[model samples]
Target chain A: MMVTGKKHEAAAAPSGAKLDLSHVSKVFRGGQGVHDISLSLEPEMIHGLIGANGSGKSTLLSLIAGQRFADSGLITYGGDHVNEHAAALSQICLVKTYERSWENYSLKEIFKFASIFYPHWDEQLASELMDKFQLKGSKNYQQLSRGGQSMTGIIKGLASRAPLTLLDEPVIGLDASMREIFYRTLLEDYSNNPRTFVVTTHLIEEAENLFERMVYIKRGRVAFQGPVEDFAANAVYASGPATVLEKLLGDVRVLHSERLGGKLLLALEDLSGPAERRMLQDQGVELSPVPLQKLFVYLTLRDAENSQGGGNR
Target chain B: MSYRSLMKFHLKDYRRGALILLSIFVCVDTALVLLMKFLPAWDMGTADNIFSINRNIMSIFMIISMIVTVAITFPLMSSFSVTRRNFYVSSLLALLAFCITAALAETAVYLIGRAVLPSIGLPVDVDRPILLSAYVFMLTLLDVSVATFLIGACYYRFKVITGTLLAIVYFGAVSLISQMFPSMEYMENFALFSSDPAMLEPGTTLLAWGIIALCAGAGWLIYRRTDIRM
Candidate 1:
């Protein structure tokens, strides 16, 4: 149905998005989900929502989708509170990991059903996806394999082409080839449409290059967020003997360390000068670039370690 | 969310589930009918008055359908997005469909019985007007009431198996307590149709439906706030 005082196409096929999630803490009665979190996402970019299990990544996503409400704050999308954006849920395609079966309905039926709310829903894309995915109309949903079922869900979210697309672990079950297909299709689609795609996953390394910005969620809060390259560049790894490395790096930040025989692999932060490099070299230290994955690991883990260590650093 | 659209889409799902369920219903009902016709040893202690016997047979089929519909609805409820704003509204619609479907299925049996029975004034005990409207309302009541706890419990708690078991255990336990307390006997009033399927008085019918609507609204509010972790 056409919403009041809004253009039909503009409402559905929104070019840019403004997503604001304020002090949104989801506290279960039993103390389980998200806690005191706040985030504002920029539009027309691939924003990665990453966190370890129980860090409230999924809870935050649910709040954005209005599948679950925040106990204490607001989730505003396109200048409207999420609940008020009931009209927008149709335009926001949420691909949940555990959602199984649209209940034996044909692939066509599934698209048709969802298409009611999404005025900008690409029917051609839906048909193309079914062909690309090779999903048969006659087969029951339960008859498909685990990967196949996931593919169907992925198709729904992608084909819906919602302006604010949230994909929560969409490629977990698929093989490398299928994941590549997903990534390529996602990039291609985003380029063509220029819509906001918020993807939450543990597989950061695979798509690190694709990310424009990253939201590293640690304990339901943004521990670190910036451009993916900048995020990876924030921490660098250097190596040498444990004592020499410690002395050379004295008060500087070190996210992780391991002594291989007599050599220490030290994940370093705040590189300064040639003198510092020489000092580390004289100590037989070797510096290496920390991959985005390692940077993520260090950022997430080091924060927890510091939170526990009483800020002695 | 567009409830009408969601409902239409859901009914598509319901068709598959319904077909499987109806196949089970038809096969069982058809088998029972065939058994009554051909199988002498399988007969219940049914009286020989053809009209009365046919009505009783139809009653047996209606009760079976009611049980099956209730049993599977729990699973469908569990699979749905129970923590959303759509939960209660969807539940009400599902219940409405369930009740209407059951009543219609039951009505079919009544018609069949009327056709098969010996010469009697209109064959079946159902009043056309009463069966038509009252079934819609009664189905609404049964569905919304049962859905209140079912939808709430399923969304808040994980595991469909555990959720269903818990709902049954809780219902049975609460029902027993209500039996013991005089003031709590009102809990049983919703099930008045089950006790006497001979339609309802207008006041009680309105009261039952009003309670269902109130419960449904309350359930919707609860669902919105409830944390959907899964």
Candidate 2:
């Protein structure tokens, strides 16, 4: 079956800045970091940075935000080097899950300093979000619950109104209803104020609909980068008899395969075209769409298998 | 503009803590001075020594405050897209302001005590020249502040374990050198300002400034390259 969903429209004329990373790399002493990542992110679009834990997602965001200097290569925003250009750095905001330095500060104090530093900080919006999240400005950050702490970071990211805002696991501790409110507020804000947003989250399915572009990182490399719809369309599951499926999927990269009773369910990547998919369907193979979360799991599992010399299982 | 704003923010953040520290010193010293006045038999020295005692306490306070300020504000400012240069410069300015404030407060307390205690029939002698003492106290506090700021920067850059070890090694080296040259007294002259205004040495003051410059430069190099780990 075809992966049918509401394809996100092309972003409106960009009020935000463009970001480009060319051959960027950062390696830690323990040998884990991003490597040779070259990517171009257009303005005024929501980009999802998806990856497994320790896949350099946070490192990549840090490099982009100038929080961590890249070991090599260049990262530019609005045609200026992010780290070298003070103006460019000022236009970007990156919010992490937890900031140890913030523990002693109250939310009111945080906002006070943020307003001084972020030239375009939206005080009214910050206040409104605080109310919506049911957080007290007088409470120190360390006194908040885990979810409340996440809300504080989220409020900062949203209220900064920077041209490029990067949120790393913004909804980590948010409950279901709070998460829904966050999604709603984010989309509403984007509609009103179009800018570049790069959100890294583990909840792929929940955020899938919000992302216009998806960048998948695997083992410190860019495994895939394209529109979310294209990412979903490129890989799929084809379940049928083992022998028939094998004959049909010749030479194609199988991301995952499992034997269920007498049948085989294979997750295949880069399926050629409609003609190939139809042919598989004609061969008594039931082709179905793969969910974004499932596709991520399958891809990571496939990489793990390949690394262990278990080829195309 | 951002630099000025950051400087202002830091001053605001630190002022309350500075006031609280100053208050604690004033309260404790006031109580001590009162006890000494009422029970002259318990008095160990001239009451005018409060000025020097307060200067010593302020020096220790300056070091602790600088370290805490850097540890707290570096990450906070970095998160706000503050450049390392701006953060460092603004922090230094704030620390200088704090040292100056502390010096003025100490001088005011001493002048007040010298004037009031003698009028109240408590014998108090002027042990040190007031203006010279204030100048010495300010310079001494500044030197300690800069040195402590460098250590704080090192702590953030190298992380907790290595930073703590480095601090221990540094103090150990200083102590060993002081023990080896007990007669020379060079370490004491290098580390502290003379409480007696007549004994104030220009060479010692210049050495303090040189050490401040060295620490500021080295700290900036480390801080500029340091990653803002969340």
Candidate 3:
């Protein structure tokens, strides 16, 4: 359903390393943090992670980055446990927003160091992209401004070309123009040498189009996940005769509903498609697709209402 | 990356602090030498030539040591807690600097001792290889060990601090409680050494190495358990 996706084509995953994050339950000593989450990530796609602060987004990234160890569950890269097996994690790269604090080296120096660790580092591409990002390679890390520092990290993440790339808000300080450039560069890079990318961001609406899949994390758990088309296809605008919309709610879960001067507007789950649309049309109903943001809000609120226990996060 | 390349990357980061430290050391050393020459000599009965290191000199060293420790650990006092990878990187740099400082301090003391000993009319043992080597080695070992323990204790207490009071209090309390108490001596009483001062004290050297290893291990363990971004 997206702009460029094939209609009759099989779902061919992007080519690069596959991530198997299975049964990942992490809890703080006093019984806090995320728990019992499980998901597998395939390559050649941009995965969006959406959540409010302290919702275990950063913790999940940290666990993947080798920054923090999980109390339980295993994160497998290329089918091997990353924490226990060194070989497994070599290809997966997680670049956190504050990762530079762990390193004091200059952008160029760190990149040089990373090249040896990440065998597939593309130096020429890094230099070219650095120019585009307007970063100073020779500058010391302490000297760069926040946005510039973020640019440095983004450059490293893109340049590494590691099989699995996790960017946790790498564009925090970027201007809108720079962010657009980043998205373009990301798309160009991915198109050329497709790798699995997981982008965690607050600016979901702007980048929703790029996400092959979106992981809307609510209260430290996967609230919803799957291909954008599949998830988007589930979105339905079931505006109809008030009685028909109300009665139609029995089998379909309506994510959102509104009464527009007695005419009803209801967003329902994706039931069996055309026949239901036809049935609704026959009953003087209306239907349409939901924007990514509306879907996020509706699903988030629904998940919150359902749980009543995710703690206000 | 290869180990040497990794080290170079970490070591290159000391550009700012090292330059700042080198300049401060140069200026302070110049000013101190001038001040010493400008002042009248303190009286030392029966030791006219000896440049006796007393309360003043010791206090200067104490201040300088604290300053160096503060400067060295500045980068670590952040929301980002150290990781095992970062621990190795920073420790390697710290170790190298510690060695270089020990060498310079020992050399300066030797020269000052040579000049001051003759002035005090004491027979200077310029060729006393055993004494010189033992004293140099002991002083170097003492400097590195003391510094390591000081940082370890400070890092353990607050993980990071800016106020001088916390650094001084934690460092003083830990060093005094651990070393001054007869039953709680550093390294020497861990049953890790059999050195007796009058009997060559060779086991003391072994104890020093053991203590260094223990501190390194402790540092790594602390880093492993701390929050990723504390």
Candidate 4:
């Protein structure tokens, strides 16, 4: 669904093999799970899955990758139901910090296993990425530092080149310089061979630019999923006299607000059209675009604030 | 393609362990046979065929090997995008191949011993045939390997406490059924080949095959429904 404000038009015909989830739910013990998550991903674009630590981003990715089975609903990829279809699963590659499977194996040994099993595995790409990442072939997987481990996971995801590649917290422990290298390499790889990628990460501002579409998950459901531009275009930061701002934002959705002296600063959702902006501008209010990261923070915190029965601090 | 890849991966993973175990077994067996021949003071009148010795050794090793391999391979199966069904089938296939190879290797070792021992004046009286004619021996190896796989799957699908408790209850029920049916002589007779290599009765062979099928089927069900913990 479009964020509370903007009305999205019918999307273009799906470009390629789409990843589709319909009413999927997977509940773990203690009631932690994704609930009724229905999303369709068009092929050959990067989508960012942004959520808080317990917001089910990781769980949703796992279900999509077929690493975990859904309790109810259907997950399909490229026209095949992934849960029971081995061929369909083979088309998707999930790169996670798998602490168990390859812990005893050396980096070279893991590469061998990856190349053997992944149909689209690119040995040359893997070797090149390994060199770039400076990962030693002889080091045991479990022996690597956290960043070193993340580098190995990144190489696997990029080199697999499956139709749908998922990287959950791919850059968990990388330094700033290394993260830059990852982004550059990721972009280069995507350009060289386009595919669908769903990356779940906490470094939103750093990686937001790379995402063509953004999916905001809150409390196990999709709060928003649309083009990144759509998300950013929907939120506006407005500041003006407190009384004027209150009257101007009368019925408009105020996601976040701050009282600075007598002037009030507000983050409003779905205030994109020229008519609303012009009307607010005429009322002597200053407006600027809210960054995707700030909008995410505002939306998530607003929900939490409402649930807890507290006004925005 | 996925099945073949999984089998190759399993073989690679198990290569080191299998080699070490086989090497140790062969070395110990060969050393003992040589000691018996060269040092008469150490030699006993008792006959020792490599196959007979390994029949017991391999059964224990195979069970351990199967359990460890299944535990290690289960997670890798998901990482490599191999389906749970394929993982179960491919692992079972790998174990079957491993058992067949071990069976053949034991037979060859026995044949070699038959030739080499006499030349060294330490002939062994192998009462049982070296290969499939030792039907109960081969069946025991296969049964334990598959049963151990089921145990590993159980531990994987359910964590330790629940898995262990369930296994105890299930085995207890099986024992109760076996006790209730005194005519199920195969349960007791299957291990009798250690003393004598009497041919397994056709009915007993059928029952043995059925039990193998049941264990393998149960293992598959557990694996098929298991969710990979990321």
Candidate 5:
């Protein structure tokens, strides 16, 4: 098993335009919360948080948004702790899945109420996005379809223009076309008005182009956090004759391996060294890019396997 | 935004419903008054006058409204990123305003009866406005809001069964305390004892404030640790 990165508190590092969570942990009654998670999100970039279901992605976002307080550790945005500080919390807007609490409110009314708190709420942009999404202003939130509910939340997240915006499953029930539109709208709006956005979604391939960085959370800890290219490059999916692949792989750590039609496919990590590349070339082994979705599955499966092994002991 | 703006937004939810309910209540009360005026020969002796009419019915409805509003508003405000402290402060002020409005409305109804009843030969012999004690009305409203808000906060923090159990125990304890202390009985009869000299005594006020403080403390303790489950 690959060693997980240690969460360190480095003051004066990643200075300015960053949201910092240092050794934050929030444990619920049934032991179903995030643990000792530390992450630093820089501004004006789109970041993706990918993990299996129940892997604490939402919990981390909740802690950052002040929806839940950490059991320990600190979260700071723009140099102010967000747990109880309104000024600091105002910097982030979190858009969650459909909530029945909004049933009594019309979309326009919800916007009117929320605009009061968010200093950078863009009324025109919200109106335009609502119109584009075909979301009726007069309909109560409960009256909308599932995709419409997602649209309302997306509109809020985008229009708030908070320095830090977190969207949890923003496209849960969106159709293919709506999902495409959302991606385009997000990228265009993000470019026009630069701000930080952290999105967690299951459809990684669809949204991978919009992400500059990806954080893979397994169980309650971060398995990986780095640039998207670096994450894709951190592991290689090699396929060739089983004998040649084994020779090429040598001592490289294999996260996942399988045989397909008399050939071997292995997810090899830490294979970026020149020596390993030369060996693979000499053996004529094929190297495929590990997409974010497969990377997430492989990492989470590895974690689950390790956890089960520990439990059996 | 300012606290006043949030208070207005929170209070706005009750506007239409309150208007409709109060309108129906006033219409029915006025119809009753008119019927009494027309039937001058029918003297139902020992009947309570309008100035002394019990408002427990309205108070019960007020208690339910407080609970429902708090239950609904907590999550809604949290979704809007309003802090728990801000919500509590705004709700406190809004509840106070609601109590004052209720008190004034009750007083108006009695004053209207006093003006109309005597001219129609229906005499009110009470020493003062018998059913419109602002102190009693305010205290009762405050207690209802605090107790119901606390129960709603409990529900926000726990599951339905646990929340329901906590709510029953909380309300039962309040009931037990009110029953055990004779002074606390004033919560049910403040208007009845409005003409008594003991109405201004400090004991009831102290007890009422003490309960309010306890409720506030308990509510803050629950709210600070709660996760906003969206």
Candidate 6:
């Protein structure tokens, strides 16, 4: 399915500037980075870039934002090469956990710099966010607590209102309440302005509700990319008697399986249609939808097992 | 327009640091000149006059300012989506502005000292304050360009320790070469301390400009391809 997003008024490109990455690869000296990634982000939608630690999510975001050039293939936004076109770059903002040189600058100063570069920067929203986050503009960045720093990055990402905003681990040090505030603020802003936001976080369940679509990267390759509901729909957990489940799921791709006191639970991928689920249910087997976090874990775990020359049952 | 904004941003980055350095320069120079005038028995050595002292101080200040500005502003600018080409151009402009401002301020101080010291029964040796300031501007510009290139190249490619060691080795080799070849001593003197306008050779000025261009070009080559890390 083609990912489509809402039109952004302040975007430099024409209304339908979907972010396109084709055959993209970035290999580091240590041989760990994204590989052969081809994906298109629909405009004006909140996308969850979910991945395990060192799964190349950050690298992919950097490549998209044009902060780092790709070693091969192409990344384009609005029909322009993002890395080579200033206008395309101006419309994208990638907010990291910490800006290395921002420590010495006051939050106000940082905002001023952002306002200068980002054509659609919302100063009023930035001020409101500062108040909401309980961050003083006069406070230098280094003086802020870790949560405060995270809040600062959040404010910048939300207020810049760029056409394509990528936030990497945006809620790293935030408390539960602040994280909720961040989510709400992000949703509210998107409601009002309607731009694309790609957020990468480990707090999958907490942020799952906010993502319209999800892209999961495992071992530097895209494992899944679709609507959140579809991602959940792609797999299911079936529980039944160990012997019966083993016999029934012999031909299926079982991502994970565990036996507990004569009962066996298996994560099964590509279990086609309602007939298969009904068949399992008729056989005294219980079928339940797998949660997103669990699905991610099971998927990655399967990849790990496969790579290690082991079968996934 | 982006270039202009970047230039303004860089100038702002250097403003506070430059002010602090200027204040220190003024305070120390003022205290020493006053002591020389008040205490006749305290011999102000021939090479230890206020002008010479201020020149050395300004050079140090400019070097520090250049290194700090590049180190701090490059990442900051990159974070704001400023292009590498714009950043390099704006940085050079800001550094040039700083050099000119410092040169003018140093000239004013020299003029004031020249006027006051004679009335206070102290002999002033320096002349042609305007020419001196122009030379100072050129020299400071060259120094800062070189410093900016070295700092940027080091941070982007070589780590700090390796860059520092490389710098030390290069300077050490130059020092050894100068010591071995007495004729090359003039070039060292021309580069470092050509205070007298009459001794300022056109070739020296041209060489300084050429070196500045080389540094700027080499710096851009390194910077344009550099990936802005975090």
TM-score per model over all chains: 0.76, 0.89, 0.73, 0.84, 0.85, 0.89
**B128-161 in candidate 5: lDDT tens per residue?**
5344365666677677777778878787687678
Fnat of candidates, each listed: 0.25, 0.64, 0.09, 0.64, 0.45, 0.43
Q: Which candidate ranks first by DockQ, i.e. highest?
A: 2
Choose 2 or 6, whichever is better by DockQ.
2
Ranking of candidates on TM-score, top first: 2, 6, 5, 4, 1, 3
| Pairs with steric clashes in candidate 4 | none
lDDT of 6 by residue, B1-230 (tens): 36766766776777778889789877987887789888988765432255657766766676666666567677787787777777778878877777777777777776787787778887766455466445545564455546556655676666788678756754665467458743333334322444554445444455456556766777787777677775
| Candidate 1 lDDT tens digits, B94-145 | 6566656655665565456546632422223333443633453344336434
Candidate 2 overall lDDT versus native = 0.79
Q: Candidates sorted by DockQ, descending order?
A: 2, 4, 6, 5, 1, 3
lDDT, candidate 3, residue A283?
Answer: 83
Candidate 5 residue lDDT tens string, A175-281: 99989889998998777667889999988888889999999887788878989888778678888888877654444367788888778898876677878777776
DockQ of each model vs. true complex? 0.25, 0.64, 0.18, 0.59, 0.56, 0.56
Per-residue lDDT of A155-245 in model 1, one digit per residue for the tens? 8777667788888878777888888888888888777778888888878899876789998777667777778777666466887677787
What is the descending lDDT order? 2, 4, 6, 5, 1, 3
DockQ-better candidate, 3 vs 4: 4
* True-vs-predicted CA distance for residue B90, candidate 4, Å: 1.0
**lDDT per residue (tens digit) for residues A1-313 in model 6:** 1112322334233334699999999999887899999999998899999987788999999888877878898999988988747788888888988887898999989998897888777777788899989999899999999899999889888878787889999999999999999999999888777888999998888999999998999778887899999987857788998877987556546878888899999888867688877888888888888888888777777677665786533
Please state the error at residue A64 of candidate 5 in Å. 0.6
Badly placed stretches (over 4 Å) of model 3 are A1-15, A29-32, A84-88, A100-118, A138-146, A241-243, A246-252, A273-276, A304-313, B41-101, B104-203, B224-227
Scored by CA lDDT, what does every candidate get?
A: 0.61, 0.79, 0.59, 0.76, 0.76, 0.76
**In model 5, what are the clashing residue pairs, if there are any?**
none
